[model samples]
Target: MVQNPETIQECIEKARQRLYQIANQYPDLWHPEVIRQSMVLDELINEYNQATRLKKTIKI
Candidate 1:
């Protein structure tokens, strides 16, 4: 399994690249599992971004 990137931008770019690859290769065969995985990855990226924002707001 591919590991997620540490930075939010890298994580998003990597997920987008994966989705593009799948879309190109499977054209009309959009698998439900792949879409689900993409959604999960997006959720993870969003969570990471939220955590990072919170960390930045902490003065100490």
Candidate 2:
């Protein structure tokens, strides 16, 4: 699946917001699920950026 940069950015931002909310709700414990989701979001953002760069390089 392919995602545009803007969409990827939006998703990343949403994930970050959710992470913050989770942290606020559970100040004592670290939730593995939330952390994992954030990590996945980061990976997706990185992948999107790399794909965009590759596309630009190919066009050059």
Q: 1-60 in candidate 2: lDDT tens per residue?
A: 767777787878887787777777767445786677668778977877887887788889
Pairing residues by index, what is the TM-score of model 2? 0.67
Supply every candidate's count of residue pairs whose N, Cα or C atoms clash at under 3 angstroms: 0, 0
The 10 consecutive residues of candidate 1 with the worst lDDT sum are 1-10
Error of 2 at 15 (Å): 1.0
lDDT of 1: 0.68
The best candidate by lDDT is 2
lDDT of each: 0.68, 0.76
**Candidate 2 minimal-lDDT segment of 10 residues:** 28-37
What's the distance in Å from true for residue 35, model 1? 0.6
Tens digit of per-residue lDDT, candidate 1, span 1-60: 223235666767777788777767666545875686579678868767676667667746
Superposed Cα deviation of residue 21, candidate 1 (Å):
0.4
